[model samples]
Target: MSKYLDCYDYAAIHAQAEHVVKHRKKLRRDVVQKYLDWFDTHCATSKLRFQQAQEVIPGGIEHNLANNHPFPISIDRAEGAYLYDEDGNRYYDLLMAGGPTILGNNYFGKECAQFIIDKAPLTGLYSEYERKLAELVCQYYPSVEMFRMLGSGTEADMIGVRLARAFTKKKEIIRIRGGYHGWSDQFIYNASEAPEDAACLNGIPVECFQSTHCVEPNDIEALEQQFIENEKFGGTAAFVMEAIGQDSGAVPLTREYHAAARELCKKYGALLIFDEVVTAFRLGMGGAQAEFGSKPDLTIFGKIIGGGYPCAGGVGGRREIMEMLAAGINKNRDKKVRVGGTLSANPLTAYAGCLTIEELAKTNAHETLAKASDYFMKEIAGLTEKYDVPALVFNHQSILHIDVAGSQHIPTIYKKDDPEFARQSKEASQCVMEFAMALAAEGTIISGGGKTYLSCATAPLVDEILGSYERVFKGFE
Candidate 1:
């Protein structure tokens, strides 16, 4: 059993979520503008850089998560728990490089550089470090009998679904609504803020989502129904979800739900796929499956798997399912799921991943990270109470959610043509963005205004982190 199992209080999390849903709140428009002005005045360098970037990069950002209200702050350097912007302004980095740097930024830079110096990153051939990384993963995650590296979380998820279909000879995949399993065409269905299935298919074809189905998080009944429905064409290939819940516990899951879902997959003959991109290492060394005591048939990993480096994604599972990815030239080709990436599990990333897992084990860093998250949750609760702000703050270990606007709690199923629901979602999203801008101006970085991924390095900055939240809460209407 993992020591971090007691790190979460699901009862408290659900109660707080209900309370916040009943009393949604956000900062006043004037207060939001006040912070936006801070960016315009204080972030001259970043503004200039963003303007220059817009000329080359569409929307002046590479990752969708980097888009801020005013403009994305240009990060010049990142040390432990803090990001130094090009304007010389320092901010507490609660984003944690979008859920990768668990030991914190640049924690083992010298070691990674030394490994790269020795191994030169890639050789278009297998590296010993890849096997070492796979061994470490299999050692910690009991569900992962064998591991296969890939290019990104999207690629990993793509292959996971494909492998499930090949292994089970099934077609459809069932995903929890609003759970991001990467931007792949099949998984992108039902991802919009609205409940309707057609809202997000701007570029992707409608037929791509035909084999994909959605269920509200923790709705075991709905999940089982989807599996039954998929039997018309083919049995559900996989039930994929973020184990904690969609958007890193924006809609949290219950332990009962986890246990039931696991059983349903067994009954329905569907592979259970946990997208542990954010929760794998940050939750604990054994990942959320171990923490919850519910084992998944296949697990999707990203972020910390490469130790905060690029090309960080993979799929691991029972040896039989994983062996379908074996490298061969048209040998049992019909039964194989083909996947390839020149840079996947290259020397540097694989070596760094091994080092990260070793360091995490050596120092027992996840427990420290959980403590820091617990502290953040407490401070946030205090601030919200003191200001009479109805906000939900919860965590699954170090993965934190601060839903001041309560956008995430909005119902997953709603009328397709309901203008009122659309308006509410738009307002909530905009307000969330503005709220994040306020926090940024106050020198704290959070993801999409509500989620904050913390690390072991966050322990020392707990007070400072809360100070930023307090300032933002104080500006509430």
Candidate 2:
């Protein structure tokens, strides 16, 4: 066992965290390594399981975020705000399935689950549940004159790009750097880089990023310049961005930047696409667009909309552009776009989504979750100050990012060569993992990454989480 494990008492944990700055290097290394070993031995089951997973599942995990230091925990089940791994260790779930499950796991009563089962899972045709859910979405988001369902956020964005090109008759796209819009080639360019000219990962063609220009999150001037040059380059089809940056450490664009970008998109005749796969309903009923008072030509939604089911995504916007997806206009001739999956709008997924929307709307779940998140951020901020750690807490309602180091300004979207920025990025990543591992050893889990999500967590649960933070921070002292 590591020395840190000897101090598992909550008071001792808090003392260690209070003096974290004094012993940063040792704590980061020992604490992180200890947790990694624990996860390998207790969480991953055995080397044989990992090997079997690798033989079947390419990367031994379905999603990259599920890959953790010692390998991801194979979750057994979840309820409320807690998850139980296959090893029977309980954890406070802060990952929240990467920002869905606003009502928490197993939120929907068996009635909702049974509803789907009784109605059958898939229809390979339109279902009343899909239509009702779309209408409910439009009820809150009036900007969506029409909506179409898809299998995942990736497909929603993929189809959005196609629609933008068809509507604008333009080829190029302008996306924000470090903003993750899904795995599709167009939006995947320049993601997860320094604040400079960083390229997308391998397997992606250089030509894919050639037409996809990237701009910084808050640089209004740079965005304007991109628009000006886009006109010279025969104009862009769409200016795509996460309404709030998700993968780039939850960085947000100021209201002024968004308004200016909206104007520039109008001036250049480029469609504005808000990739709200993670933001929609998570930020508010109408999402960041409604919260920030900005409107985009197209919006993509995922996560919370699906209600923790496998159901993933959809695109919604003005009728004119969305009409292209109608029977006659689309070239696919199957009364659908050339892009669609058999499970795109399955009845079970649609029922789950609709039920979730209904519950969320009835309980005003967003406001409650936001309050819980605000409490968490405030508590963490207090812990950081008390410990004299150079940490910052950032959140947009229910979603939160704990920057163990200070937040760095990502000036240009695609420029990734700045050494100082790189150093800060690495430190923040290390601090987050280390802190999270320490918390995990104390019997709490907050995603094991730099961020945390709040589900139907109540004030009592928030207090318990804060107590855990207090324990962790006190250890540093």
Q: Give the per-residue lDDT of model 1 (tens digit) for 1-477.
A: 001122255556555655554456768878987887899999999999999999999888998778887888889999988899988999888888888898888998998878778767778887898999999999999999999988799999999999999999999899887778888888888774434566767787789988888887777788888888988987888999898887777777888888888898999899999999988888899989988998899999997899999898999999999999857467687767888888898888888889899999999897788777887787787788888887767678788777776676656433436675576666678878988898888888987656688887877788878888888888876
Candidate 2 per-residue C-alpha lDDT over 5-116 given as tens digits, one digit per residue, 9 for 90 to 100: 1111323323333333223331445545666677666665534466679988888887766655555667788888788877778888777788777887887758676876
Assess every candidate by TM-score: 0.94, 0.87
Off by over 4 Å in 2: 1-30, 33-48, 193-201, 326-337, 406-424, 475-477
Per-candidate local distance difference test: 0.82, 0.71
Q: Cα-based RMSD of the predictions, in order? A: 3.3, 6.6
Total clashing pairs in model 1: 0
